[model samples]
Target: MSEVAENIKTTETVAVQPKKPAEPLLSKRRKRLMSDPLDEDNPITVQVLGICSALAVTTQMKPTLVMAIAVIFVIVFANLIISVLRNLIPNRVRIIVQLSVIASLVVLVDQVLKAYFFDVSKLLSVFVGLIITNCIVMGRLEAFAMGNKPYDSILDGLGSGLGYSWIILAVAFFRELFGSGAVFGFPVFESLGLAYENNGLMVNSIGAFLIIGLIIWAQRWRNGYVEHN
Candidate 1:
């Protein structure tokens, strides 16, 4: 009778043990992780990390879009891998491991571009390889991925990637539209049978600088973000 009673007590104790609550997939904190970079913490206009690529590849939308996609892949996967391995990584070699991970992903992206999208790859030239040294990718791995959980790191990566993507896309949009009167090489104005003169300024780096500056100003104005002087 005591054995049965003890068994019952054990079962009851086991049954009453509380389970940890599952975190919501898109908790308020997680949503902020995904949203903050798109506006207030933008990599390009706000953080000012990837201006060179913006200047170089954004003359045409096709190459710019390809670069954006490549970056998004690299950043997302790199964050996930690093976050998963964060604990196992030795502090002294963490930077080296992070670089190795980023380099491997960038090589994969570069090869895929070369194998299938050879023409765009050629257009991209060294730019795809240059992603290895991009500040945004390195910065995210160091800052967010090194400390956060895999899922949170991924959301941070997506946020930063999309933030970078839209800014370059916006710049490329204006540059392509005015520089060549096209969108994704569709030749929009040409299709409309309107003879749109390509703006020489929009075809040059000066054009990108001007557009980026205006965007920075406008975004800050809209968001009311101010530098602490």
Candidate 2:
């Protein structure tokens, strides 16, 4: 009788206790947030964000690489700051707050580039400052960082920044290869002893546009992404 009573008491205790949530190193949704933007949800190719910088800075691989690193630094830090302060920001002025955070990070990036990469910074010029207005940084902050935990926001920023980085790097690769017959100022054509004329059009802003558009098209097709009517 006592054993039966003790078993009933144990059963009641277990029934009343709440189940603990899973605490893995990384949740499934967090991983998705980090990875999806790399391809399927890419900010540039899929969402079509941050096209101006892609066109402006992609003429040469050197400057383009510097710009990509700068953007990644700015975006990751900005997202982290905003995510940590997400709940404290007022709704009426949230946009302003986000912009301020982004602008500060951009300044930090610009200064670091100027200090460490003076020549590349000169090549970049106003474009580095213009990162303050980049839609990708602001968009991610508002959409993902604002609503997510700091770790998830960091992943989202890293993914989005890389998404933009790889596309621009590809654009720069082609532009430098065909436009100047070189990659990062090394004469590939000359080194190979092959005669090749640099394509003037490939060094132009229009070339960046065409390349990025074609890349977006190819990515969408590969990913089976279609627009709705």
Candidate 3:
């Protein structure tokens, strides 16, 4: 009789135990949302958004790195704010509302940069203010943030920011290396005891355009992305 009671108690305990909840961090959809923009669906390389700053600020890596961080902050916060307010926002004024949110964030970034890192902020100049007009930030807010949950919108913004960051970083790396014979202001060629002449063109705007064009071509070819006639 005691053995029968023990068995019943064990069965009841087992039956009452709850199952583990799924890990939101490891969800397939979340992974895809973050990873897709790094390559095939990249905002800059693939979709060709945010190219102005890419060309303007990528003359050196340090300033480019700061700009990238600023952009990431603006995009993620803007997306979160927009997503949370999507339901409350009026349809007719959605564009205006989105612009307002983005502009506010851009001002905050600009002020913070001015307060600290003033030199790099000065280097970035009007480009930092121009984040307000970035199409990537606006596009994601309208297309994804308006419809998605806050968490998903944040991830989309992050993926897009990172996508833009990497491409510009690559451009800066090459430009600084060949253009100034340095990386991040360090005299790389000088340290190596090699006499290197900096390429005048590499430091100029045309160099940025050429590098971006090659990057676009290489990425598209590798991904089998082609214009359909």
Candidate with best lDDT: 1
**What tens-digit string does per-residue lDDT give for candidate 2 at 39-148?**
99888888888989998899899999989988899898898888777766898999999999898888888888788888988999999999998899999999988886
Candidates 1 and 2 compared by TM-score, better number: 1
Where's the lowest-lDDT run of ten residues in candidate 3?
A: 9-18
State each model's CA lDDT, in order.
0.89, 0.85, 0.88
Order of models, best TM-score first: 1, 3, 2
Q: Which residue pairs collide in model 2, if any?
A: none
Q: Could you report the Cα RMSD, in angstroms, for every candidate shown? A: 8.2, 9.5, 10.1
- TM-score versus the correct structure, for each prediction: 0.89, 0.89, 0.89
How would you order the candidates by lDDT, starting with the best?
A: 1, 3, 2
- Per-residue lDDT tens digits of candidate 3, residues 1-229? 5643443343324324424554355378898888998998999888889988898999999999998999999999999888777777899999999999999999999999899889988899999999998899999999999987667788899999999999999999999999999999999999999999999899998999989999999999899998779
Model 1 compared with the native: what TM-score? 0.89
